[model samples]
Target: MLIVGLTGGIGTGKSTVSKVLRDAGFPVVDADVVAREVVEPGTHTLEKIKLTFGPDIIKNGALDRHKLGDIVFSNNTELARLNAIMQPVINSAMVDKIAFWRAQKVPVLIIDVPLLFERGYENNDYIDKVVVVTTSPQVQLERVKARDNLDETKAQNRINSQMPLADKIARADYLLDNNGDISFLEEQIKNLMTELKGIAPKYGTK
Candidate 1:
């Protein structure tokens, strides 16, 4: 199967594109969803996290993501520490999902990872293509602020926490501009799907 890594900075419409791909019948393994799964109430990963960051970050029986986000997003050291604990598990889960899809004989499989480059998934030999979704910095800031209900500085901080969009675009095999409305974005995705289908066969036999 042609394994595609789909990524974008926070509030860059990566989820929207993933949804479109899902609607069009492609299998998409979302890293955020897998991240949550790996840290569920009784998991070893959650125990390690609690040990590392303390138990206050857990609410009821689950990891309080917002609480953890508040802690890590402001502190690079803390964020790196968290990534150190989580990335290996997440990567393993993603690889398992890709193998599952390949065994099912799918032509293309999309791995929706927000930190694809940050976590080094781009360098993986199995990843056939990397698609980065982008938007103007102003639009990105506004969307992040509105979606997460944060002030300008906090939203900007969240945006700054990731690798820069310009750097991601420079490394992209494909780019999806999300500056316009959903229809515009969908049209681009339609064209992208055509190209992906054409390329998938070349890698599917691997």
Candidate 2:
């Protein structure tokens, strides 16, 4: 299988691109979805999280993500600690899912990892391509602010917390500019899928 690592900063439409890739018949292993899955009620990871952050992070027998997000986003140490608790579980699950796709002879597998470069995940040899979705900083700020109900400074801070969009684009084997209309974005993805399928099969077969 061809493992394509897809990444972008918040509000860059990474999820939107992932969905298009899914529609193109590629198996997508979404990290955010997997992260939420690992912390679902009755999981050991949830127990560990409760132990680490205490009871207030949970509410009504489910992980209160907003409450935890409020805490971690404001504190770098706490954010790192939360990542320590979650990354291993997420990575392991990703590995298993990728292996299953390969065994099933899937031609392409998109790993929708938001923090692919930020968290030092570039060294993974299985990633046949890196596709970075990008948008202008101003547009990103506007989108995130509206979506998250955050002020300008907070939205900028969140954007700054990730690796710069320029750097991601430079590192990417493919680029998807998402600053345009949805139809334009869809057209770009369609072109990319064609290009990727041609090279992806050659590498995976070798």
Q: Write the per-residue lDDT of candidate 2 for residues 3-111, one digit (tens) a residue.
A: 7899998999999999988987888999999999999999999999999999998999999987887778777888899999999999999889888888888878899
**On residues 105-126, what C-alpha lDDT tens digit does candidate 1 reach at each position?**
9999999999999888888998
TM-score of 2: 0.95
What clash pairs does model 1 have?
none
Worst 10 residues of 2 by lDDT: 197-206
CA RMSD for every model?
Answer: 0.8, 1.3
Task: Supply the global lDDT for candidate 1.
Answer: 0.93
Which segments of candidate 2 are over 4 A away from where they belong? none
Give the top-scoring candidate (TM-score). 1
lDDT of each: 0.93, 0.89
